[model samples]
Target: MARRATVYQVAERAGVSIATVSYTFRQPQRVRPETRELVLQAARALGYVPSGNARGLAKGRSQVLGLYAFDMFLPCDLSAPEVGLDDLVAQELDRLGDVRRFPLYVDEIQRGFELEARRLGRSVMLGSGTSRDSLGSIDLAGSVDGLAIFPGGAARDLLEHVGRGVPVVIFSSPPMHDPLHHITVANESAVRELVDHLVEQHGHRSLAFLGELAAPDIGARFTGFQGALAAHGLPVPEEPFDSTVLTEDSLRTLRAAIASGDVPDALVCATDQLALTVVDLLARHGLRVPEDVAVTGFDGIIAGRLSDPTLTTVRQPFVSMGRLAVRILTDTARGLAHPTSYVLPTRLVIGRSCGCS
Candidate 1:
């Protein structure tokens, strides 16, 4: 077997130092164009392929970005009793086949990360850390140049651990006092606008928020919900329909609420996924949407568009957020100034579900 060509051989053939050959591959901007061309030609003639490990060692960078989400790939809980499917709902779900296969929000963000990373000459490494054990187990310190984290699944201790060694950008979560950077949506403002639409346009006085108030993002939405109601001189509901995810438990709770004759004029869900489940559950109980009750959701996911009464939602700029995350991480890697926190804007999407034309 023939021995593989080395950087030394390429340097000798190109009449350049070994350091120049390394610089040509790792930091071409530092090498002159003519010298770079000469090194490339020699490498091509020698059939030399640069080893990623060797390049990383030389440049002290992996040229890769790591994306960590806790529930990005968690499968939907399909344990609810089978109700007769609505034609529009079925079609919408079918069209969003990828959402069904993976977590919608995470998948959309990943798509954005991939596109921007490619343009920046970097690759993405995706992983899920749904629990403390899993979050603490990943070895990300030396594997990538920078990291983007969802931060919902991991604890502060775990985040501090990984972030101590690399630059990290958090997504969909609030900024902490720690040195880690953040890229989050305008959750409170978006929810405030959504609630204002419900009250001012539709006169939905009796409204209820459905979400786990303990969660950071959900808590922010809840704050917006309360603020909007307060602005309208309406009292906050005694209790919020609490559920972290749209599961059978959430369905059962909603059923109980309906049975007790406590159904509100409008149901404000924290996420589009939750809203989709609520709409389906309401249909099963023979409640007409936007007629008997109005419904609104955040995160303008694809399924929301295809519902029988299309969901009224705040369309989060997931793709743009992903791109921004990459840009911040890359900037940090390059010793450039980047914002410690960013709150991107969201737009209200009027659909029939919110009783809008």
Candidate 2:
């Protein structure tokens, strides 16, 4: 292999001082445009790339933002550092069909985050971790000027800890009483509107909420389901069905429900991931969506549009949510704004899967 070109070589070739080479890349506005162009031209000729780390250290800024997702787990082999890049965008391409573990929500949001970061001359590092291990989140914190986190489990505590030293934004969690910056969606109202459509328009007597209650977002949505039932004067189940995805046990339980004629007229799922998988599960048992039973999901992922009967669901502003988080962090980093929390909105999407024409 050939030897890598050094800054000294670039500085010598550019007919500029070493300091000029550094300023040209790190603070081009401080240098003459022609000088910056000369250094860039020399860099291209020598195939030399300046080190982002060194430049960051010089300017007391990393110029990179961190996005640490909570409640994500990986297989043993995938946890190894040498195995793969810790980026959500690259991983999302092949996960569309893996409904239980599909990466649509985070991928869409990350696309917006990444695009804004690029536009602002910042780099982004994406990471996923569970509460049991925090080394990944910490390592990311050490490298970023600001960080965005998904709220859950011990992550709230971590968010606070990181916020003490740098700007932090947490998204998709329960509303916090504290003043820490956060981003949330109108989960309850959105689901309530969805269920309202099922009862008021379709005259469905039996509507069951389907999802695990451990997640705060699901809990909020289930509350909406209960509220809608109460408004219609219908009997509401004491709890949700406790199954969302198509796992073996969940499938077995659902199959038994069908066998015993206990199936509801509609299933209000907490997420598109669960609803899409349940659609497939119902088909295996010869149940037709919106005919034999209706189904609705939250989070308007793209795959919902392609389902046999296009999914009726609520669409969260995922891209805007992401873009807003980055804006908050970048603004805070530059002293342009103070950290604040926000509740984003969602809209109900009309589609055939919910028994609507």
Candidate 3:
């Protein structure tokens, strides 16, 4: 049997000390570039991969960052010897039916996070949890030096609990867990600005916000919707789409509103995904976008660009937020005082959906 290549072998082959080999992987910036290259070249030759457990035991740190998410990661159920067709069909449906589930905000944030982790000479581990398991986060927290988590209300307690032990960064949620760091954009102000544009320039009178306030960032957008309506002397809705989350019930209400042919002058969605849903619903009911009901979304995801009207919306710096989270986690883990929470900026993008073309 072949032996697993050890760091000592790489160190010997590179003609460097063991510490230099460790620093080359754990903290590459501290090593001279030529020396780092030599070590890496030796490692490649010997198929030598640094051991996170060994590194942690010796240096008190794992050179791996975790990106934990809330049930967003799903793969074919391969626990069995072979996944049956029925299981595969259900898995694909489960992946597709989930709106904004993947290849959107979360994917964009992960791309940024991975990029930053690589920049810092660290590897990233993606951990995902379903609603059924609260312990998923606990197990992941134990394995990584730092973690960047996607926000979900169900994981609030777990997030706070993990923050106490590890350098944790929360993304796209409120700063309710003050002890933990956050990488969020200007949710309220960006929505406020987007809404103000609709009211002032497009002259949208009866504007309705199309998402629930259960999510903190979505709630912030709703607040901006109310603020803009009040500023325009328009009636503010006490509840949004039955004051519920994005579930079947709210969608039913949206369908009924469209069916009755009494929809608002404009629909300001909490997310680009919701805006796409609205666009589809309106089309199903024979309503034209902008010409009949103007629509706008908040997140500047790629889908919004290809939507029939090319959605007008606020673009959050998803990638930048990701990069910033890694910085916060790595810095905080280094015995530096906890970093301050960050609020990155957003931009209002004018597109055809809002009649801006």
Candidate 4:
């Protein structure tokens, strides 16, 4: 093989000090973009190769990020079965080990991360958000220069403290405090779109919404559902069924309401799981889905596809959300100024359940 080029040669070709060259490749988050570009150009021209040993010695640190994601692993564990648990856990662990691993999940986002990491010559270490008590001792203490946190966990306070020490980006909705970055979907608008599709296209006027109404995101969804009804000039029915759970008691209550001849023409669930449960309950009551009462749900989960009369839903760009979180965190790591909240786009996925086009 040809003689390997040295960092000294690369620095000389780039017309920058050895420190700048090292920061450009090793600790890129600490260097300016223009300087990084110059160093990369010099390396390419001089046929210089990056040596891990040289990079570590120059930067005084490893080029890796501390990433935390509770979203994927949480839902997967809840939805997937015990038999497949081992495989799912392995896949999750693999996600953490992958060098380009931060919080990025979508395809385009992954591509962007790969490009940035290559240009910066850095790697990432993925970690799950701690279960509150173990938050501090969970290796986020100074192992990495940056952090990416998913929503719906007790580590918020811990992350807040970590944010003070390093750049932190939270991938969640309902915007957090300033200086901390967040990436989330347009939850309300997407729910409105689904509700409108049901009412206008599918002829559903009387409707009921089921799910945890206490959640901020879910509350927004309910507002959207009600707003759609008002916009359509549809009267809000008296005592629309509000269900906390899809257990036998709640399902029986719905069945009784239907039997009493005051059933909602449509039922919009807060999640795919709730939607599936409602569908099963309605069937048990001799109500044919869509033919008797239409249904739609939020969160385009895989289970929705398999449910009878495949569920119509609002697709909450989970993958994109993951990727956006990664981008924001990396940006913060590099000392770039970004907003506290970034609302991404969401879309409606029509299915047989909605009885619409």
Clashes of each: 0, 0, 0, 0
lDDT of 4: 0.68
Tens digits of per-residue lDDT for model 2, 1-357: 989888999999999998999988777899998899999999999999888778778878889999987764323224435535556546656655654444478878888899889889899988877776777777888889998887556555667777777888887775577656778798888888998899889989888888878777888899988988888899978888655443445655567788897898998888887788789888988899989999999999888877788999999999998898889988988888654768888999999998878
Candidate 4, after superposition: displacement of residue 94 in Å?
24
TM-score of 1: 0.81
**For model 4, how does the per-residue alpha-carbon lDDT over 1-357 read when each residue is reduced to its tens digit?**
888888898889888898888777767998888888989999998888787545544565546665565533324335555658788778778676442223223333334444555556667666654355446424663666666655444455666676777677665456766666766677778877887787678776678877766445777777777777778897653333665654445655566787897788888888776787788778877888889889888777666766668889877677566556556666766667778888878879988998854
Model 1 residue-pair collision total:
0
lDDT of 1 by residue, 1-357 (tens): 788999999999999999999889888999999999999999999999888868787678889899887655434433334556696478557766544334488778989999999999998887765656553325765588888987776777777777778888888878778888988888998999999899889988888888776558778888888888888999976457655565545556678888987898999999888887788888888898989899999888887887779999999999998999999999998899987888899999999998887
Q: Between prediction 2 and prediction 3, which has the larger TM-score? A: 2
lDDT of candidate 3 over 1-357, digit per residue (tens) = 799999889999999999999999888999999999999999999999888788797789888899988744423221235579999788778777343445788899999999999999999998877655778887888899998888665556677788888988888876663688877788888988998899889988888887867777888888877887788799988878535344444477767787787788888888887788788778888898979999899889988887788999999999998888898889888978755578889999998898887
Candidate 4: worst 10 consecutive residues by lDDT? Answer: 99-108
TM-score of 3: 0.80
For every model shown, what is its TM-score relative to the native structure?
0.81, 0.83, 0.80, 0.65
Q: Which runs of model 3 end up more than 4 angstroms from their true locations?
A: 1-50, 73-102, 242-250
At residue 165, what lDDT does model 1 achieve? Answer: 80
**Reference-based lDDT, each prediction:** 0.83, 0.82, 0.82, 0.68
RMSD to truth, every model: 5.7, 4.8, 5.7, 9.2
In model 2, how large is the Cα lDDT of residue 315? 94
